[model samples]
Target: MRKLIFMFFTVVLAVGVISAQDDLSGLTGKKAIKKANRAFNTFKLNQTNGGDDLKEARRVIDYVVKQDDTKEDPKTWVLMGDIYNGFSSFNQAQKVLNPDWENIEPNGGMVAFQAYKKALELEAGNKNALDGLSQIIGSISTAGLDAYEAGDYMGAFNSFRSILDIHDLLKENGAASPLDAEEEYDNQLYITGLAAMSAGQNATAKPFIQKLYDKQYDKPAVYDAMYKLTIDDDVDAAEDVLTKGREKYPDDLGLLFSEINHYLKLEKIEILEEKLKFAIEKEPENPSLYSTLGNVYDKLYQTNYKEGKTEEADKYFNLSKKYYEDAIKIKPDYTDAIYSVGALYYNKAAIVTEEMNALASDYSKEGTEKYNMKKAEVESLFSEALPYFKKVEKLDPNDRNTLIALKEIFARNNDFDTSNEFKMRLEKVESGETIEKSYFQ
Candidate 1:
């Protein structure tokens, strides 16, 4: 989330200097270091083209780095860093144009980072090592973000981990680190954890997320992750974490939805409106929340109508219609919301039809007038419900409910021909022919 809160940068290809090539057929110790440096400088200057300097650089430095005397020298380690770093840049640049191009050193970036760290350990004030370290850090950060954006979670994690390793070493040596601040450190931890989690490496993810939990990271995402992680092993503990998070962040949209879903499972519909309204306030553009709020009021409408509380039922009916229309305004193609609005009108018409039927036996003057008025209201409700169900039929042609609704509305309007057309389609669907995939073909 939020680009991992990393400062995205274009890694600068900002350093390459040259020196004369030298033969080192029998070179050892300081002579070997001189040969390696010469090879490194020339290779750095010419690696992108077809050049033999990279072979020369690898040949001398690979053997020289293992010698005890050379290994002790900070200059030797600095040269090692430069050679590998240049190799990484060359291979990566080449691969951009030719994806199948061979990577000369696939591990070059990590090797460069390790070599630079070694140089600093040997002599903390080594300027070449420091300069090299600065450049490679940006390179690694850019690579991490690139990998993340490309959906390579594990690759992103490795690059980010290398940056974290460097930051730790810098801290241990009392040097400045870009992620030294507590907030930045926590952000890095969260992102690193997120990458691991996305990669399906929960074992690797636990430690990074655990660090944030221990430090009481303020963001609600941590609590959400922790809740999910703990749920399988300890349900009680998972509930506790969710409870605490909801208490701390009552208004956070994610946490609010978590609570909303919990009550939904428990069948606690009465308490959902306030929570859903709060969620709407947090994410006004989200149609699902408005749809859910509409569903809550729709249930209330059914309950009050069944109890014959017409005024209360009408109030909830209006509320349900309002939120459903709000959701449709936001997402025109939301099938469930569209269908719910149509059902609301249809059910209300059915109730009015029942009332009109009750007056069928009363042929008195006032009773006939009331029945006529109720019949007109019933037809009006059916007319209001017609377009929505027709839209549903177009959006999902195989929908049985939508087809049935269309047939009835058409018949009610004296359009028997159109009603019978849908009736035949409905019969074919119920007989399982139109339900088959071959039907569409």
Candidate 2:
């Protein structure tokens, strides 16, 4: 009985101590702040290098945050942020000490960010919270870049998104944001949009891209991405976006090209012609533009020829030659333009050959003359294309296309020996063998 009574008294004493500790109504404004600061100092001093010190710091700060008089106080929130920051620091140090210890509790950075954000909400111009927020932003930015470089795009997207969210929240709450508003949004939006698109998260990318477009952000890539995303489902809207982008960024070649591509897709040939002409006007010396225009006319020539409109087909073929000549004049050694010109002559000759093959055998005197004239016309066209193909070979000695063209052109011109040589070279190129000497040279 005496032992039981002593145990009861011990339990009663323990309950009284617990009740007093749990009761924080008496600990208000100044007292609560003082205790929080003291706990913070103890944690910072790292006297014990133990979890107990950090736990105690968090307990005191949380108590201050929960107290009636200090619940709305900016100072209380600042203390909460500091406690969490200390938690993060302690966990980092502990991880260094014990490399295997991975389960660091409470996500200290997130907690600190939230606490700082709350402090700013309560006092928009709070310098302490702003400084802490800046540190958090810097850290997050670093994390995002690391994740991006590692091809962890989703991780990078989340990191960048958090930064934007914080900035937006600060602005929405009438806080004095330290971030350069327009520049920050522009950079973050572009990266986040691109990351989201790369991750195959179209739903996530749309808003970011739309925001950039709406703001007329001076980013050509945004317009390009926007058009690519919407071109299939809503072509008109995509073209409208392209038009607006071009209007705003008149010199942006990307937007100009996107506009050209849109009209090409719609089969609006007249519009395509106009757009290409305008682009050429803007950059008359750009070889690529002339090359593209040449290709466009090549396609049109084929279209007209297929409809049996030989006269119209000849017109487009001549136009194609003009552009190809223009491109070659600007960039004399342009391999692609040179190849296109050669292909044009070769194909036109093939058409004439088809016509000659369609005629009857010319054994009679008059028939022989007609057949020979038609054959000469075919050979002349192939001859015109031959030197251009040879030039292409010199410009790009290892080009597979050039090798194939040389073999065919020689065979057509009845130079069987030279044709066989080019065929051997083409076989070697296809087999990935190194060619020591230039075939044409």
The best candidate by lDDT is 1
Model 1 residue 346 CA deviation (Å) reads 5.3
Candidates in order, TM-scores: namely: 0.64, 0.66
True lDDT of residue 16, candidate 1: 29
Q: Which pairs clash inside model 1?
A: none
The predictions' CA RMSDs to the true structure, in order, are 11.2, 10.6
Clashes of each: 0, 0
Residue 212 lDDT, candidate 2, scale 0-100: 86
- Model 2, 1-441: lDDT tens digits are 999999999999789546434645677766867866765786677646466556766777777787778889898888888777666666556666886655344356667788988988898878888777666665566556757887988888887787787677666655555466678768888888888887788778889988887887877899888987787779788888788778778888888888887777777776777789899998999998898888889988988998999899999999999999999999999999999999998888888787787665658887777777888998898889988989988767778988887888789878999999999988888999867777667
Model 1 ranges with Cα > 4 A deviation: 1-36, 45-80, 87-107, 114-135, 169-177, 200-203, 224-254, 257-267, 282-286, 302-314, 330-333, 345-384, 395-441
Q: Please report, in order, the local distance difference test score of every candidate based on alpha carbons.
A: 0.81, 0.79
- Per residue, candidate 1 scores C-alpha lDDT tens digits across 87-195 of 7777768878888887676567778899989988899857787677766776677667768998999998998888888787776666677787889888888888888
C-alpha root-mean-square deviation, candidate 1: 11.2
lDDT of 2: 0.79
Pairs of colliding residues, candidate 2:
none
